[model samples]
Target chain A: MQETIEKVTKVVKKKRAKFPESYIHDIARAAERHDLDDDELDELVRRVKRAYERAKVEKGEAVGTVAAQSVGEPGTQMTMRTFHYAGVAELNVTLGLPRLIEIVDARKKISTPTMAIYFEDEFKNDEEFVRTIANKIGKSNVNDILQDFHVNFAEMNVVAELDETKIKDKRLDFTDIINRVEKAFKKAQIDNNILSFVPSKSNIRELRLLADKVRDLQISGVKNIGKVVIRKEEDEWVIHTEGSNLGAVLKMEGVDKVRTTTNDIHEVEKVLGIEAARNAIIHEAQRTMDEQGLTVDVRHIMLVADMMTADGSVKSIGRHGISGEKASVLARASFEETGKHLLRASIRGEIDHLTGIIENIIIGQPIPLGTGSVGVVMKHK
Target chain B: MKHEMVPDHAVLSKSESNKVLKKMDIHLEQLPKIKSDDPVAKSIGAKEGDILEITRKSSTAGKFITYRLVKD
Candidate 1:
């Protein structure tokens, strides 16, 4: 024990010798300003340095004295964002500063955390390669991780990455948006000419098939808002589209099965083909507006949902979504109890469940929180 | 190969040598393995059934490796 203590002391002394004189001066200044005694300051510095040393073993910014004070900020709120992957329809997700911090931290080191991530859109999906990248990133050594995954942590912009991840989506709640663009247009001194044309009822199925093509619009692909017209041009079956993929429209007009579009951007051609998803969001928002007594339009919902889900993959809104387990549990608690109750519960213990304990049995068919039977109360008078 | 002691206990076995090398981020291939029948063994005047000790980190820890030349 004495030998071990001596050895540990030697190591500590060596480490303290490496600590810059400037650091000690800074600590001394803060201590004097804060009215903390010099002895207390020295002890605090030693503790912080120990923590910093421990932190250096992991992948992140070293948890120094400054980091120890600013662990987490309470009373902060989160906003939603959208991100698109491989140019599929937008998938929405909730985002905030915490989420931003996560992205910044993730990008701090070259290696990223990996899950059983499923790539949704086309751009040559390599599940195996991506999984390999995930596994490599999960390791300790950043040098090894970067070499294995080919990522440069030093070059990454943490703030920009946070902004991109947390604020990428432009999705609005249905209740939060105006239901129609006419009011917005009126406010902005502009009007969109609605050129109405009635198509024949015999080709309704064909129109639906053509509408299915809207999902393939990518960053490199043509962008078009479609308006289908079925007016006969010289006795021919003319299925004309106003501001959509002319190629997609032509393919549907002349064929039976709908074919995918190629990567091309011609002049004065199709606008971004987000109409079907846009319409779906609009209709859902309209329903919410009606239910919630809101006057918001489908477009705003589309924009918000689009912002949230601009990424090709649609993350679910429930506990299973991208947020951490603590946040998810908090979200679940909000449904069971009041928001304040949940906050109180959170503060009562540092973890989501401090007092929450496991039980072996219950009154009803016990819904176990862990593996076996969980206990629910049945208090008798 | 001759200078390399073929230990009676085989303390520095093939796998053990490789494992030590691995901890140092190297391989046995990176180390100069002595032959069992090299003339340097005769020069050191080491006979068969004699023990040869190779110190590593410290003598007390026995992280220091030794071999017994018990082979013909």
Candidate 2:
């Protein structure tokens, strides 16, 4: 089968000359799947060549506006509210229109940040290991495992009664919690399963406050990760987190670094790179569209992603980003903050060369698009 | 970390870059940019002003090739 695939790829490369590697690979895989004979394979390559040629965009096409319209038209039909994420009632993920807007805007602090965490090959099938990881990832404070925090005025300390059932359920170590408490407070001591801590001020109010503080102390898991849902996706148990901490999650052992991803675009850029961030933008936007049952072409989303990441860093689509950075002063002034942009441009002696479509349209000149983009020079001697 | 989404990025040498610039008819500044501090750029040891060839799997084109100039 491998030999046949290689033979077919070689034939396609020679027959439909200069076909891209991806196209050749696709053709070869299709031939293998269909168990196509030589004649059928030849016809497939020919059709692919014709299709490829037809798919090419003409030079000087106004792709940006077309992409904007394509993506924007379907966006109007999306739901405006958040929804429980895929039967995980605990997680309320922003979807549809709001999510699509969030992605394009490239907001640094995205609402409902989440992560889909995969495990390493060795730990993927291990349910016990996955459950432990989920426990480790979901933030659990002292209050979660403690039955109650009592202020002991007579003893000049606060007593925190531990819930054995909760401890066992969470797979928390009794000694580990004690040690954490000891480290967090100066005079914390443990007896049986109860932890007692002396307040610094040594008063009733101080004791009450200390008990509150102790209850809020994080006993386990990575910070900012709220709730974790361990689900069976296809063959393996995957962890879905309500909050995201990509940098910390990637550092842990048995976590699949490559496959584990966060919905936070800026975080992805900070941890991975601009390229990864661009891919994230495309993935996120496409997902939002798919969830809404909208069918905007992926190329339109890809174009928007490329525009957002064209610079070294990710920028938003609106005034503070790509639109604001346009070479033409008139274009920037035309977008938003008209007075401020025009004033800044005038003070800086910025010139609007009337090169772009917006500036040309503003001055009632022929916009440099399609037939207008072509230039003709005629001279008679 | 070899993230799947990052695709394949290769640094083009001076001669190869010159060919690309000539073919595209654009200056280095006109190309899309990648920061020198970018994780992929740092991993590949790409210095500022160097050109990177990024090959991504496109939804429409099947294969897409883009160039980025590394900048601080």
Candidate 3:
């Protein structure tokens, strides 16, 4: 083993390519396993060296442009419609081009916010337990629990008749609903599953406004999470929610916090910080592309994600984010709002160093990329 | 086989991380980054600017060491 290692090291040292130590060790092990003589070992080392040399990226290669083209070209081929989630008919997710645009734009509120919540080990297979957890995570308003709402214009009061069956089905107490409504409106009165709201002054408009407020009042569960559909996948049950409330859902008991993911990027940012948000952008973009049978490299997604979150926050690719905030005045102007950007820069006495690609391109010059990145210096002897 | 079963991951000390940076002749930003919220980064409590050393089992070599900068 020692002799083989020594021969491999000697051959690697002589090679021009800077092969990693692991590669050298690998060659030595393979040579030993084959029981190769000195000549065979040397040939093996040479082949490994050649492969390493071939694998390395060449200097002055326009990587950024290549990455952009690789991603953008396939992006044009992505589907334009929202896709129905697998197994669940009612649940739909914004996929393809719109989703890609949303990710790049770093939009705070997504068109259809969704969450896939997995349960902990104890509650994983228990359908009843999972259903209870889903109910807890789902937002329930007074209108959702109430069967009928009657208005007594003469008395200037609104009466909400609570659904007894729904309250029982959801495992919610009638008093709990009453208490919640009472907290929102002081003049609320409870009588045998009938919650009444009396206006201070007897008026039709005031009664109508009070009734609207009472109808929209959230009685229980996490806010913004409207519907949760629990589906059994193999042995375990997963909760798929229509509305995403990542912050609240994560804190809930029986929830597998680590695996639970939401479609809303900003919600993820708020709950898990900017780094998690960057990951979400990458994961979401890749998933969108993959679902449409488009294959873009993971590194491209990483590069885009890194650029989006480089400033410790998620920023859109276009103006009002990364492009608009460029160091060079001309680069900013060239991206969007050319007149406004140029005017502002001139008024502020800003100078363009012609550093970025866009700025250089606008002035009809070779951009500082590839061969144009460096300038030759003449030496006087 | 045991070593291959579990790849070793460790957080480099401040001085060790600096030495790595010096040896590579690269700034922290130049290194490939891993998010601070990454599972491995979180396990070691690796903050932004911290360097993580991951040693993976290799078939050719006994082990292969790689470094990643933890970023926000």
Candidate 4:
């Protein structure tokens, strides 16, 4: 009730118009079918009128004061009879439905508040009364209400394209999933065209394999390559000039100053071809999944690997690639020193706390820390 | 009389019950108002100001109570 009042007051202040109580009374009918008692109804009108009065004062024009909620399109909703099925009881609820015509955007929603009251199932064993109630709600609405359990579909976002090829892993492709979704929509005759393609079990397995292959650089380009180093102090940052007469190291923009002790030829080759490696990773990942005849989008593979990889040197799906979040603690413990304290804390921390007792004995009398503050404590529950 | 005009589903509603009683050549003081809070109106899915026709299949002799919705 307060919310409605505030809403009305705000809208009235915005529009700045004045209308008679009857006019305000009419607008308040939007929620009239909510079955509010007289007091609630009166309160709603009072708030609406107050809104108009406020608008009038703010705008300094009595006649021009108007609230945003216009009078009477009442949205074609009318009071009706309904049976609301809840947990264990079926309530014979008086309902109001918006029966008017309007177009709602796929992005928009209209909320209609409702209240259900439980009453005796007087119609029990009374088929005629039951039929009357059903008929009044209409067959179409009944059908809609019955089939309300069907799930919805969401739109798809394509990340990578998969080409049919050979690989070590098998998974379904994305396009194929999209095809299945579109076909489902068509078959179901659902009005919504949007759908979310949830990854299935097989899809996840293939995606994992793809992540491993791409990170290893068995094919495609080098995408997972980290920091590069060069051999000859002069060739470190510079592109390799020892090629079949290509632009060579120093000639490539910003490559002239590479000073490295790590083999310059391989260093420059890897540096100049980082993109090729990344693409190669992408290609391999795609092939791994594609080999299984799965048409999954390549983006998922890339996301998994990128999210998993912290350091490229340790190319692994277990901790380095996909399970990285859980793998770190395990890796540090297994590869390095394990903490006895941590293990003890994990095992007996709760038991230790529970065992420690602090009680007042009065001297041992159990005089405790708060012993001097006996009468200072007051608690109310 | 109103019930005669309406379908068999019509009853002196919570709101219209008094009016119906008056039409039957009786006064609100004479016939029952079927208090707005009566369990009967709830059973027919009628609220204040709404009317419904109920048929009492086996109870109270009457086939049903076509009552108006009221706040009592």
Q: How far off is residue A56 in model 4, in Å?
A: 46
**For residues A1-381, what per-residue lDDT tens digits would candidate 3 score against the true structure?**
778777888877776556666776678789888888878877777887778778766887766678789889998898767664644667887888888899899998888889899878998998888887877777788888888898988777898899999987886667777777778888778888888889876788888888888888987778788887888888899999889887777778888876888888887766665556666888888888898889888767877876887665678988888877889998787778989988998899998888878878889999888789889999998
Each prediction's whole-model lDDT (CA)? 0.31, 0.88, 0.78, 0.30
Give the B-chain TM-score of model 1: 0.34
The regions of model 4 sitting more than 4 angstroms off are A1-269, A272-276, A308-314, A319-381, B1-72
User: Which residue runs of candidate 2 sit more than 4 Å off their true CA positions?
Assistant: A1-17, A26-51, A378-381
lDDT of 1 by residue, A134-154 (tens): 222221111111111211223
Per-candidate Cα RMSD to the true structure, in Å, reads 28.7, 2.6, 6.2, 36.0
Worst 10 residues of 4 chain B by lDDT: B1-10
Give model 3's docking category.
Answer: incorrect
Report the lDDT tens digits of candidate 4 across residue range A102-192: 1101001212111111112342334443333222211111111121222212221112222233111112233443454355334222233
Clashing pairs in 2: none
* Cand. 3 TM to true fold: 0.77
Clashes of each: 45, 0, 1, 64
What DockQ, between 0 and 1, does each candidate earn? 0.01, 0.70, 0.15, 0.01
Candidate 3 has an lDDT of 0.78
Docking quality category of candidate 1 according to DockQ thresholds? incorrect
* lDDT for position A112 in model 3: 86
lDDT of 1 by residue, B2-71 (tens): 1011111223545655556566576334332222332333345544533333432221222334332323
